[model samples]
Target: MVPSAIVTLAVLPLTPNGKLDRNALPAPELASTSGYAAPRGQTETILASIFADVLGLDRVGIHDDFFAIGGHSLLATQVVARAQQELNVQLALRALFEASTVAGLAARLNSSTEIKVSPLLPASRQQPLPLSHGQERLWFVEQLGLSNGGYNVSAAVRLTGKLDVDALSAALSEVVRRHESLRTRFAGRGDSAVQLIDPPWPVVLSPEAVATEDAARQRLVALMQQPFDLAQDRLLRVALLQLSPDMHVLALSIHHIVSDGWSMGVLVGEIETLYAAFCAGRPSPLPELPIQYADYAVWQRRWLEETALQRQLEYWTVQLAGAPGSIELATDRPRPAVPSFRGAVHRLTVDQACTA
Candidate 1:
């Protein structure tokens, strides 16, 4: 049964400098044992098991809400996958969001329930494709003469233990083959750009030995700035820098036009999964993704004319009525005809006590 009451504690974590460290906030913990009611029957028992596993909890109650107890969209995908494997039923991601409780979702996901991904976009290689919303915005700004490197996103991870270069490379290849967006490039014809999903071009994951970790950091910065030909080459690149025999740093830089934070998370997660399987000498264990970025773009464009979207657009229009075109930030240099994107970064660590 659902807990009779939810204890809401208003607490936001802060760094030592007192600035709100929103990222440092911990996940919502399970309710105390006194308040939780375990699954009542077989259906709920199974569903509860899956929920607890995905949520990293020892136990879950039939009435406990998925999102209320630290669940998120990505973890929701894991729940759907687990359900498909164990229960032989397909649960839509939306279904989980709708039926948040175990009993509610269990009722919706019986034996007949099946999961489905959006259909692929019906476009040939020769035809032009529209960019995703994020890409669309970034592309427009880039055409305004912004530097391309401004859109580059990157992350570096350290590798320890037995680092298998061959398997790591193979794993990235498999990941690229699996996600069309990773293999995608943009070709501009006038203002509009066509997204081109390139055929398999494997990454070279060999690590170059750097004298020290500091040297690796310098190289990573250089790699991040390397200009990409969005009209021709792939938008993603990877490098493995060997700081020492036992320590390696993996760097991946992707153009923001074809990627976002969520996509990067999927990329890294899939790489880890594929690498593990490859190192073990097994085939790719990752299941086929139900939908890709292209499919989503197609779906968005098709549904743009719906009443729901119209209402949203109208609301936003009124909300932003007479909004200024741009904010005049204090700068030493005069504003150019177009943004030069001559940007700089400064780092500071604030004390949490002073911030809060």
Candidate 2:
């Protein structure tokens, strides 16, 4: 993969043995609100406010680049949802990505027809909640008894200084308390399945001692490869691997059904924020989320009923008309009925002239 951005450091972090402490290298700072341009109109003002709220910024300028200011596809979805709720304007997720700035997004909203969007609210706990459409596809694959480790979304970071383990544990617990998806479990309802939310509970940051860095890497990989029981176990996990007194690796793993790449980024940001606050013996600075994952799931099921469902089916029908049902690819062996979800690496060498 190509490098996204390079950060210049005065000096690289070195280990006790004077070797480069690769893990201690700081993450690149790609987002900056260097230039500020205030919003000029009501639509732009509202759009800017939504962006600021979703990104956890004090304020957002009309000309600010959303992606440059720590926005992603998942956050863009939130911005669109909030815009629909506030302005009664239907915004496509793709449209938000294309025209990410407040001024550009306001222009799109001004030209587009207004539509009604059902407000997402907490669903009743008396009844089981249905899975979101995206979650349903993952659940179906899980039902096939295939490899589940492929669905793990994981991240690792190295903490170089003395870490307050208790504060870290408290932060993880607070995060699980804040995000309902982490406390969720799936269960079968006749032929289909539903999600069940459990009350907030304590979380453990299991510690492991590794003799060498290689051993620590292996342990972290094993932790990530561990599968979850969708019907019983919690979907999120965290572990701390200690290589030395001041060097440790923090590992986190969550099921893809409850998280994705973009969501993982959001989770990391929130975790760091909470950890810093807890380390200082301060209360959580985060505000209560307007809606939880269960609310979104419930809203999705309701929105996809009747007209929306038929409209989607008809649109795809016309688009896929006369298309091949499947494509034939030459393989070393026939594909298995149930996917193994295994992958391998194949390396190739190309001439410079051919590349050119």
Report clashes for each candidate as comma-separated counts.
Answer: 12, 0
lDDT per residue for candidate 2 within 116-183, as digits (tens), equals: 35667878878778999899888887887685688999999898989888888898899899999989
Tens digits of lDDT, candidate 1, 1-356: 54423546587778999999968866555663335787877778988998999888898888888887767888899998787666755356788888988888877765334432233454444556678676777777766656657778887788898799999999988888888888887778677786888787787777798997678879999999886777776888899988777888889999887777887887888889989999999999989876777766765664454323675688799999999989989999788776665769998999999899
Q: Each candidate: what lDDT?
A: 0.78, 0.85
User: Which window of 10 residues has the lowest lDDT sum in candidate 2?
Assistant: 111-120
Positional deviation of residue 330's Cα in model 1 after best superposition, in angstroms: 5.6
Which regions in candidate 1 have their CA more than 4 angstroms from the true location? Answer: 1-127, 306-333, 338-356
Which 10 successive residues of model 1 have the least lDDT summed?
111-120
Clashes of 1: 12
Model 1 TM-score, all chains together: 0.61
Question: Clash number for model 2?
Answer: 0
- After superposition, the stretches of candidate 2 with alpha carbons farther than 4 Å from their true spots are 1-85, 89-115, 340-356
